[model samples]
Target chain A: MSTSERLIESTRELLWERGYVGTSPKAILERAGAGQGSMYHHFRGKPDLALAAIRRTADEMWATAEAVLDGPGTPYERITAYLRREREALRGCPVGRLTMDPDVIADDALRAPVDETLDRLREHIAQIVEEGKEQGEFAPGLDGEEIAAAVVATVQGGYVLARAAGSPTAFDAAVRGLLALLAPPTR
Target chain B: MSTSERLIESTRELLWERGYVGTSPKAILERAGAGQGSMYHHFRGKPDLALAAIRRTADEMWATAEAVLDGPGTPYERITAYLRREREALRGCPVGRLTMDPDVIADDALRAPVDETLDRLREHIAQIVEEGKEQGEFAPGLDGEEIAAAVVATVQGGYVLARAAGSPTAFDAAVRGLLALLAPPTR
Candidate 1:
């Protein structure tokens, strides 16, 4: 990979591990095997480089979600696919994890991509719910936007529980419970 | 307050604002208005002081949750009261926030209090759900542990969404969405 590509990838990994505040330009350069001059030549500074990294990560996350949400299947099947998609549960969501960093959240440029990624994902999920409603797959009174919000929260929160317990059991339990709630009630 | 007490309080505030990795001993001492000699005399170092601060915060969080969970009311009422309780939504959950701090999670001493706090809180909520089930407030097939996990995740994840959006509206939406799901469905 080119120096710029390597730098951005290193920054993304560092951001996930050390967060924006804790990650230093020196560390990123070292991780990327690039010198100070090379880093500065490629980007304005740490913040500038971080913005690039954040946006890249955000796009990747959205693309992954889109694959599941826009997959060829019924709304229930697609939503379930999204929920059951393989994930590094303990590592947590890259975009969701960035929200915990005060430095990242404080910067409008850094925060925008993160916000848009989630907003778009939630909208996509809401649209699917809307589709489900149209097909009579859900109760007519169910609010698509509200259910979408809950779906996103459940996934994000599941990571918190999983990380805390040092096990994914809690995460699985939470997802199972949510799925049970979403299942069609038997007569 | 005594120097030790002041130091712990300052550490707590810094931890909440910047996290364990981002917070430094100098920052803690400065915030406490204590000198280097006094800080070192009171504690071994930042880790020692941080452990005390984390434990203190954990206790405070548990006490606050218990106040809402064990209050006089039906299970739903108590849970709703806890959810509706005023919070600095954008600032995030103090204990839950620690999970995102690599330094905090890497240290066994630092991580224990954070882990235990969340565990106890989930257990506390699960017990409430169990009671609600017995009282016929929740569906008979609902898993108390699972529902409890979902409730906790919603709050933690809600902070992520709120901070990303730079608005409390996302947080409110997440909470309302979860509460709607928890509401009993009429046949």
Candidate 2:
């Protein structure tokens, strides 16, 4: 890859590891194997480079979620697909992880992509819930938006539980618990 | 407070603000107004200090949640009270925040309080849900554990949304949406 591409990729990895507050431009340059001039040549500074990385990570997260949500299935099936999709449970969500970084939250340019990604995902899930309700897969009075928000929260919070224990068991349990709630009453 | 007490309190604040990976020993000492020797005298190092702070934060969080959860009210009323309790929406949960730090996850001692705090909180919530079911406030088939997990996830994810947007509106919306889901249906 070119120096610019490598710089963005390295920033993404470093941001995942150290977060925006902990990561330095020097570290990014070192990780990418580029010098100061080369880094500055391609991007304005750390914030500029970070913004690029954040956007890339945001897009990647959405694409992954879409693969499950938009895949061929019934609404319940799609929701299950999204939850059961293979993930590096210990590593946590890249976009959700940024929400914890003070530096990332303090910057509008950096935080926008993170906010938009989650908002879109929640909206997409809400749409699926609405479909489920129409298809009689869920209780007639169930609130689609509320259920969608709850669903997304489960995934995000499940990561926190898993990471804290240094085990994926909590994450799996949280997911299984959610699926149990979503299952039809007769089953 | 004693020098050791002051140091632990300072570490808790800094850890909440910057997380375990982002905080430095120098920063902790400086914030506590304790010199290096004094800090070392109280604790072996940053990890030891962090464990104390995390435990303190966990205790404080549980105390706060119990105020709402253990209050005298209907099951739904108590759960709603817990959800509506005042919080610094942008700052996030102090215990939950640590789960995002790479260093905290890397060390078992540092992570124990966070894991146990969440685990206990989930159980506490599940117990409340179970009571609600027994009281005939919820559908008989509702899975108390699953609903409890979903409720906790909403709070954690709500903080992420609020912080990312630099507004509490999203957090409020998420909570409101979740409460709507938990509300009884008019048959």
Show model 2 residue runs off by greater than 4 Å: A136-142, A182-187, B184-187
Error of 2 at A176 (Å): 3.3
Winning candidate number (DockQ): 1
Candidate 1: regions farther than 4 A off: none
TM-score of each: 0.96, 0.89
Which lDDT tens digits does candidate 1 get at residues A1-187? 9999999999999998878988999999999999999999999999999999999999999999998889988887788889889888888888999898888887889999999999998889989988988987766777888888888988998988888878888788777777767765642
True contacts kept of 1: 0.62
Clashing pairs in 1: none
Every candidate's chain B TM-score: 0.97, 0.97
lDDT of 2 by residue, B65-84 (tens): 98889998888989999999
- At residue A22, what lDDT does model 1 achieve? 85
Question: In terms of docking quality, how is candidate 2 classified?
Answer: medium
TM-score, model 1 to reference: 0.96
